[model samples]
Structures are given as C-alpha cells and as structure tokens.
Target: MPGRRARRRPVGDALAGTGRFTCGVPEAVGVKRPSLDAVRGFDRAVYVVAVGQLINVFGSGLVYPFATVHFHLQVGIALAVVGLGLGARSVTTAAGTAVGGYLADSVGRKPVMVSSMALSAVALASFAFVPALAAAVPPGVAAAAGVSRVGVAFVGVCVASGFVAGLYTPASSAMTADLTDAEARDRGYALLKFTNNVGFGAGFVAGGVLYSLASVSVFLLDGATSAVVAVVLLLYVPRSDVGGDEEADADVDSSAESGASLARWWAAATQPRVLALAAINLGIAVMYAQMQTTVPIVAKEGLGLTAAQLGTLYVLNPLTIVLLQIPLVDAVAVWRRTRGLALSAAFWAVSMVVAWAADVGVGPVAVGVALVGGHLVFRTVGEILHSPLASSLMSSLGTDAERGTQLSVLEMAKRVGIGLGSFFGGLFFDYGLSTAWWGVLVVVCLGVAAALLLFERSVTPRENGAFGDATES
Candidate 1:
C-alpha cells in the first residue's frame, strides 16, 4: 500500500536547491497551504461563514435550554411532550447534516454550505412571528399565565429551527478545512469555536430578557441575524474556484473514494489512528455534556442551591472560555499532540472529582460553597486543549472536497456519543445521592483510556494525495 508522503520541508528543499519547495502555494486559513488560486481568499470566507454559524448558534444557545424549562413549567406542557419535541429536533438535525455531508462530497462544499445557510435563514425568520401566533390562543396563554399551551406551540417552532442548524455544521467545518493549509487548521477552528462561545454567552443572557418580555423576541432577533448572516456569506464567502489542501505526490492512493479516494476515506476511518481520534472525541463530548446537565442537578438538588445561584455557574463558563481559549490554544500549540491530550484528560478527571465535593463543606447556605470553582478551570483547560487537536485531526481526514463529509461523519459520531451518554447518565444519576458525580468520574476515566489506546495503536495507512501529506494513519 502507498504511504503518506513525507511532510513539506521548505528549509531542506531550499538547501538542496529545489524550486518545488521554494515557491509553493500560499497558506490557507486552517490548512497548511493551498496550491490553487480558486481558494485564494479562504480566510475571509471563514469569517463570513462564521457569521451565519454565530447567528444560528447564538439563538441555539439561548432557546434550547429555555425551551425545556418553559415547556415543562410555563406552558404546562407534559414532560413527555417536551422530550418528544427535543428528540424530534435532534433527529431532524442529524438527518439533515448527514444528507448535507454527502452532498458536500458529491457536488461541492461551497454550494451545499451556502444553500443550507439560506434555508436556515428561512427557518429562523419564521420565529419572529411566534409571538403573534401565541396571541391567538386563549387568554390564559396570551396573559402569560403558568403553563400555556400557546407557549408549547412556540417551543415546537424552535424545534424546527434547530434542524437547520444541524445541517450547517459539517458543511461549514468542511469549507474551513478546504480553504486552509495544515499548519493553520487548528487556529482557524479555534477561532471559530471562540466566536461561537462568545455568542453563546451573550445570547444566554439576552434570551432570558427577551423571553420574559415576549416569548418570540429571541426568535425574531435570531431570524433577522440569520438573514444578515446569509447575505454576508453570499457576498463574502469564496466561490468554487477554491479547492482543498494540496495533495502529497508520494503517498496518494486515490481509489477508495468516489470524487475522493474511497479507499483513503475508508482507511482513515478504520485505521487505528483515525478511529482512536473518533473514540477520544466521543469520550470528551460525553464528559462535556454532563457539566451542563448532571453536574447542575447535583448542585441544585443534592447540595441545595437556588435556581439563580446554579444559573450563575452555568453562565460563568462562556465568559471563561472566551478569555482563556487564546492563551490556552497557544500553549497547547507548542506541545506535540499527544502531550496535549494527556494533560487535558488528566485535568478533566480532576474536574469530575471537584463536582463530588462542591457542596461538601457549605452546609445549608449555597452562597458560600465553591466546590465547582476548581472544576471550571479544569473543564475550560481540558476543552481548550482538546478542541483544536480534534479539529486538526478531523480536518486531516480527507482532501479539500471530501473534508465536509469526512468531518461531518466524525461529528455525527460525537453527537451519537453525547446523546447516548446523557441518556444513560441521566438514568444512572437520578437513582442515588451524588450518583451523577460518580458517573462523570467513570466517563472521564473511559476517555483517558481511549486516548491512551489510540496513542498506543497509531500506525500510518495509505490515503489520497492531500490528506496523505498532512496526516498519517
């Protein structure tokens, strides 16, 4: 089998008097470099696409959390009803992303991406009218009394909106990878994630305010912003002239994929190296999900904290992520990938234990307790370390054109992990005292084990031209 080509070495080539390495294509945002002029303005495109992402995701940050609460209480919607709505939206998003991922492979990353964003705009645009829709109901609903059916109907609207978001991620991630070179990949992805978190934090606060004044306010704002995002993306996002990363002349075995090397995609997915990365992603996302869901439950019920206090802890994370990600990213960038993941998982284990004790010494007053403070630092640190690495590895999955589908599949794996993890964890935790913390501990441990397993098992595999250059099996 053909193997990955040796890495691009500008210095060595220059010393040897080889012009091939001396005058190469310019570097793209997330990739190491590009060989095509079509991909010339990749950096600007990322920002434009990011606008659409932020517009949709900011609304997601606010509405997803609020919908459950609103439906379960304010709308007097049954718990089953709320669960079904949430689950339906999740399935919709998953299906949409899966389809979009394939389309990215078949057609091209840009058209699939821009088209999805446009549809997303339509979905969000409908949200602005939710208030008027709610008003048509009985006085109990319009009056904003407890548990209005009208409010539940609006939650249904949000469910539809979330489906569109699901379709957008894989295409966007693929486009980012397509536009850049290997070296810049991590930074580009980190920047995108940073923007997402910043938007999330602001939206969280804004959602509460908007929802209180008019349940539809958040939707209206989100919808309009999505429209603006679509416009920006259309004007600024690069066209198909831009292709994916440059192929390595040596290791390319282009028989596996369709337009892509199908065998290459197969090798990366099945190979120990790529599979290990997938496992690690699954483990990390599981732990991450618990922080929002289980950890809070333990704090509120077991430790006895008021809703406001618990909420403060939740809100603190977004601000903390935005501030620390830059330095953390830089620091991790200095280390080899293995060292970063090991250090990250080690700290993550500590965060789980911290939750076990957050309520320990505080007695009845939730005010004085700070058990979770340490966990915040650890969680953020772990996230900062893992995110860039994950992005880098996933971006290395396929050539430029196939990047979205490959990455999208990886994302789907992550979502599957998160979905099952939360489901099982919820079942396990609701059974006993401090049960969730213990479960989290178990999950973190499993992540560490998987990371180590991958590290131990990595072996290079034959791949297509572009991906073969930047990544090994």
Candidate 2:
C-alpha cells in the first residue's frame, strides 16, 4: 500500500467487498527494474549469437583438449611434430585475424562469421575422416601418400582450422561491439563470457568422455556443432549492417597523421592510449599463460600430485569463472574500469606467491589443496575483474569505421602474449621453478599494474567513465 496507489470505493458495495487487491497498473510503475530493463534492451542478435557460441564452443571442447594427445598417440605423429603443428596453427591464426579484421570492416561481420563457421566445420570433418581415408587407400596409393601422410593431412586441417578461426574472431567480436553501446558493453560481453565458459566446461568433460569412448567421435561431433551454429546464425541473426559507419571518426584519426599510407594497417591501432592498454593486456595474458604451461608441471613434479589431482585443479579455474563471473562484474560496476583492472592484477600477482609458498612443506595433501584452492579463487577473481571490462574497453576505444581493424590488432597483441609467455615460462622453468613461478610472474604482474596506472593517467576522463557513469542498476 505504501508504494502503490489505490482507488476509492464505497465500503458497502458488493463489488468492493468481493475485490481482490491489484496494486499498481503498468503505467503507474515509473521505471522498470534493472534486470527486466537489461533483458528488454538487449539486441536480439546478442542472444542468438550467445546460443550459437554455446553450441560451437561445446563442440570445440570435444577436440581441442585432446588435439595434441590424439596426434601423438592415435595418429602416431611424434610429439615434437605435434608441437610444430600447433605452432603453425598459431601462426596462421594470427595472420587470419589480421585479414579477418580488415574484411569485417570492408564487407560485414555476419557474413565473415557465418562463412568461417561453415569452413571450420569442413576442416573439423576432415580431421575426423582423413585418417580413415588414408588407411583405406590401396597399397600403391598408400605408398604414394607416404607413411607420414596421415600426420601431414591432420596438421594441414589444423592449420586450416586456425585460419578459419582467425577469419571469424574479429567479425564476432566486432558484432558484439556493434550491438552494444559503451554503457552496456561490459554486461553484454560479461554475459557472452559466462555463456562461453559454460559451454567450454561442458565440452571439456564431454570431450574427454567421448575421446575415451572413440577418438574420432570428438571431431565428428565438433564438426556437427559447427554446422549447427552456422545454421542457427543463418536463421536467427539479422543481416542488416550492424557495424555503423564512423567515417567522420576515421577522418579525424587519419588527418592527425597528415597523410595515410596504403600499408599502414597499424595506423588506427597506434594511438598512445590504445598502445598502452594493449601492452598491459599483453602482460596480463603472459601471466595467464602460466596456468597452461607452468602450473601443471609444477603441480605434478614439484608438488608430487597425481595426474588426476592436477586435472581437478585445472577444472577449478573455469568452474569458478562460470559460477562467479556475472556477480563479480556487477559488483565492480561502480568502480572505474581501470581501477578494477589494477585490483585484479594485484590479486593475480599475489596468487602466484601463495601457490609458491604452498609447496614449502610437502605437508598434508589437504593443506596443499587448500593453498592451491586459494590461488584459484584469487585467479578467478582477477579474471572476473579483467575479462568483461577488457572487452568493453577495447570496443570503446575503436571508432565505428575502424572497429574491426583495431580489435584485430588487439587480438594479435593477445596472441603475441600467449606465444611469448609460453616461451618465457618454459625458459624460466628450465632455469628453476621459483624463477619462473615467483620471479618472472611477479614481475610481469607488477608491470601490468603499472601499465594500467599509466594508461589511466594518459587517457581522457571519458575513457575511464565506464564505472563512474554506470548506473547502479
């Protein structure tokens, strides 16, 4: 009654006596709740794409986790060869990203995404069928194909998959940017990340199960999911020009250089503020790379953990993210994005130290577990702080006309971080576990924090406004 308006009626009237309470009319409600408003305001394409992502990622999950293992064991490729194949994939992926970004800007986002999905599906299918085909060849034909043919074909397919992925990444990212405004981009991308991880976790488990059951089934299912995603996009995503024209912004940026070179793909990406943020991102990514290369080796060899025990630790990272990502993003919605990023970097930095200290005693396994769990919690906390805000920040930095090109550059920076991080992490580990886990990682984290501070200072007030101006709701 306090919050609602009531109509007066005669107390003795039968109608009044029989009436059940109806509090407020729709028109009388002055504003919608934030949750409802958020749902109502979302671009239909975002939801559609989210669904497609879930399907596609789950499929990818089945094969990606087992790729190296499959090549080495089932395909009988040497471990070193498999490693070489992976490196080749990364190289193609980087090149593809650059080209994809340019195309997303030149043509459109949806076409590039849909086409890439379809192409990737074909590549995945080849991954499944090529081995069987190679085996079935006549003796003479098989001789012509050579003993290494199966391995070569699989690697080629992997390379193609990488290139296709590159073609799609910029378009997909730019599409999300096109659909969201600066204000809503964080939540939009947050939801996307949440959806993606859910799929990723599911895929990780399911892929393992399928791999054990039948190795090739993983690739078949992965390819099927890709096809399904392509179909879904074709049916549901709108075809309108989503990446808005920002010719004026492009003109402004171009004029500052006095002249534009035909070969200067980096022109839009070289803004001082953009470069600084990209550097900080690269640093954080280097720290992140440790989870894959450094953490597992240390856990097994240094901590005396079993393979199963180590797997459990790996699971904790995404599980924590899937459960807490949204709440964490919402919690920090009131803080400046830059400040939030710095806080996350600190958490990540401290987590490495905690993990290092946990190994001092070789005490109770439970104690080790507790310490590692604490590290995971903090790492995920940092992830929550970084993931959504980072996407939104990158999106906000780009103009409409150059969004795809600029974002591709950002993606390349990330790839560079991963490549270099893995390289340095292995080098450090070779020297000493402490050197890699403590010295290198800690220094990188500090650099990330410092870089972020510099970025905050160098950028205009508007750039830091994501949290300051974000409505509480």
Model 1: per-residue Cα lDDT at residue 237: 65
Question: Against the true structure, whose lDDT is highest?
Answer: 2
Identify the runs in model 2 with alpha carbons over 4 angstroms from their true place: 1-40, 68-88, 125-158, 244-266, 294-313, 354-361, 364-375, 426-438, 467-473
> Which lDDT tens digits does candidate 1 get at residues 45-147?
6666656666656766565345544454455554444444444454466667666666565555666666776777667656556545666667665356454
Q: List the residue pairs that clash in candidate 2.
A: none
TM-score of each: 0.70, 0.75
C-alpha lDDT values of all predictions: 0.57, 0.67
Name the best candidate (by TM-score). Answer: 2
Candidate 2 lDDT tens digits, 66-94: 66556665677654445445555655776
